[model samples]
Target: MRGSVEHSWGWGHCAPSPLLLLTLLLFAAPFGLLGEKTRQLLEFDSTNVSDTAAKTPGTPYPPYSLADFSWNNITDSLDPATLSATFQGHPMNDPTRTFANGSLAFRVQAFSRSSRPAQPPRLLHTADTCQLEVALVGASPRGNRSLFGLEVATLGQGPDCPSMQEQHSIDDEYAPAIFQLDQLLWGSLPSGFAQWRPVAYSQKPGGRESALPCLASPLHPALAYPLPQSPIVRAFFGSQNNFCAFNLTFGASTGPGYWDQHYLSW
Candidate 1:
């Protein structure tokens, strides 16, 4: 006859051994470190738009006109009809990605008029303001069923539009919530985030201006983190992690002037 081995804690029921419990905890530790879900809102790479890369060298920086570049829209899993973008060139659309009901998302890159640039093109201006516009359908039914939040970012140089600024507004009758500018322009990220000042929903589009601590501009290149200052609302917008979903129009303006070497991403 062979003796039987039984495993039990102080209670009558059998329990896992200390070593096994430690192994289970160790296995689960990684999951805790896993971050929250983050959708790639928009990414722009503009390093290849130098004078040397331009089709005609020395003609003028940014060889191709901003209007000549095309937008590569990535609808990865959203209804085509529901999402739309108003850009200069014909957009390259892909319908293969999974769909998220009532949600529309896409991305575009700035390429040369004839061929895609080796890198993303910077929104440089010699005499006029350069702008990009995007629109999304607001959430229906309101409450949790509605879209969670909205976030935007620019990866390249400092304040893509130092002299110009982007405007955001909603069409619904109900006054939409406002997001105050993040205290820190680029919060702990390698990017220089856009600092969006608070503006009343009733105000005319492009009428509001961003409030900064100092008039001096940080000309240096850094990731832009344009998120609200409120901790709770900031997290809600996913600005802390980098993500946003909102229905609004972005208009860039130089106010009858020209900006040199400015940059923008979408």
Candidate 2:
């Protein structure tokens, strides 16, 4: 179980339905939206950790960004008019959420046209580069092109391409496969966005040196540099959504010492 990657679907023997199909790993993200205080610890309140909260799809997306918002009655991070996200599996199943007190969370592969009011939410992958604004959530909304990150797998690749490439679905308007995204990077950011000291915590570590789910470790393992991005974001890595259309890229390059894999703690 230490190094295994799970691709199972259909939550608990329930028959596959539109929502179930819509919520598969190829289409889902963990939906662990936590509440205030902890939510506002790094980013602001209200905004999801990804920081792509849009008023109307334009440059300069708004808060939850460190210097920007607050965490009051928060639920979904997607905009019903322009975007939506689905969970790939049940919350407890997301290994990424097992750290900190991110007691809850979800995973997302891509965004989609808002279809919930009329139909099940459609999972939309990029036909081309899905260029939307991005923010280092838990940081100031007006960042100096700041850095954001997540701990990834050690091998620098995953079990397959990002999702089911070219596969259409019942609740999706487009195929949700993000073919180019084979790796995720938080190379040093348990707290650091750009640079942080990597700490080897797990035995037979697979990715860029990480601790195996600490229920309560007295010593913090990672030391982030250039100051931590948002203590708030770190605390809710698994449960809080850490992405958006703006700051996210279709494909990116990982710099030196950066091992980019998708899982947070594998």
Candidate 3:
């Protein structure tokens, strides 16, 4: 009878002990936080200069200007708009780390442009574990493609972003050519009712200036929310040309932990 007892524990039958299970879960806790906390760095530089001239705009938009932001016209031939512009030092710019009201403001008339090309806009955070909540408000007269979104250039353990090059060239070998966040609009302005739609841009692909959409993964569908019409967007007109306007603001802060091991294991 003892000889007839069934036995098949040679392999693949080991059970996970309680201690082993606890250790495994502890290793996964930080990773769980990684996903929900990661934030997307929407780079606002000149390399992503508007290609169209700022003249009689409709479909073809113009490039942004540096002088508009009180900087020398560093970019040539490209004519974007800057109807009204203002800038102040960032809070971090202070050596004391004291809380100071460091902010920029602009008011664009309808059919005008508003650009911050020189002192490229930035969305800063203490850690990469975060999310971006952007609300674009349009006021005054509205123009075609009256929308606001983000442009990303992935830099993995690299230095600052490359100098913005002409529409046809680039200096940063790791530059990205595609605009990742597509919260675009193409109609008249609505009341200021737009809310922050969360998104996750996984910085996976890291190389060249063209492999954009493929480099990073788009985490959600194109955001769909009601448009806002109050606080008219300050339009920026190009060198004696067309007009366009909009404002960007971050509203909420959240921790990360949704997609850690899934896409950001590194």
Candidate 4:
């Protein structure tokens, strides 16, 4: 008589209801966020310069003269002059990260000799269209006007050369892209072929005879977001200390802190 009572739990000794299981599943569902694959295509930090970082068909180290090869942080403007740069001698897989596309990013910095006559360093193809993105992270002058950006022809002759264009004048000017940030230091680009239309340049700031707009209001031609501007199909090039010789430099650091992850498609 003492063990006659049978015991049962909340489920009445049967299976749980489907509603309960569904509720649990709803709470456990994963939030749909972009994975590394999307990051590589859209983010500046994620993009890798595989072609240049690893030895590939298009990217090749330029032949340096005398002293060539160096390294530095683009964010730190205090470092001294570097001599040369070294891209992958051959294409290699980046063990750390992978992308939707096989593209990789390699950072580099260099200095060109004015006497050499090569406005920009010859690293990648300059005879045709190529994506060119740059950031003015730090500059010697320490002002908006001081830092600059460059977009040149990836192939053929550069507009920087007089023979390329009859009235060339985009040379040695601060890139309008930098204006988007810290509006106080810089503004929008001027109204002209160089600012709106994609064209080559060949003039210096102090030496130029034309009056370009000080600020390019509205930063016309929005980047990312609603409308990503056309990919910058041009050559890669830059200068050290405004108005100096065309020193070609690329390394771990060469652009703004965000440049590595983002680039305007050309």
Backbone clash count for every predicted candidate, in the order shown: 17, 32, 36, 44
User: Which candidate wins on TM-score?
Assistant: 2
On residues 1-266, what C-alpha lDDT tens digit does candidate 1 reach at each position?
Answer: 00001110111124344333222222211111001111122211222334233221111111111122233332232223322122222212323311112232222111112221121121221111111222222212121111111222222222232222334545322223332222222223322222323221111122223211111122322234332232322322334332222211111111110011111112
Write model 3 residue lDDT over 1-266, tens digit each, in one string.
Answer: 00000011011124233233222222222111111111121222222224332222123233222122221122221223421111111223333432132221111111111221221111121111111221112111122222112222111111221121112223322222322222321123311111111222212331221111111222222123221211111111112211122222111111221121112101
C-alpha RMSD for every candidate: 23.9, 18.6, 26.2, 26.4
Per-model TM-score, in order, reads: 0.21, 0.22, 0.18, 0.17
Error of 1 at 140 (Å): 5.4
How many residue pairs in model 3 have overlapping backbones?
36
The runs of at least 3 residues in candidate 3 whose Cα sits more than 4 Å from the true structure, single-residue gaps closed, are: 1-58, 63-128, 140-145, 157-266
**Tens-digit lDDT track of model 2 for 1-266:** 01011122212224343233333322221211111111111111221223342331123222221222222222354333333242212122323432223322222221222122221111222211111111121112222222122222111112221211122234323313211211222223211111111121222232223322111111122223122233333432432232311121111111211123222221
Question: Model 4: residues >4 Å from true position, as ranges?
Answer: 1-82, 86-101, 115-266
Better of 2 and 3 by lDDT: 2
Q: What's the distance in Å from true for residue 236, model 3?
A: 35
Model 3: lDDT to the true structure: 0.20
- Give lDDT per model, in order: 0.21, 0.22, 0.20, 0.19
Q: Is candidate 1 or candidate 3 better by lDDT?
A: 1
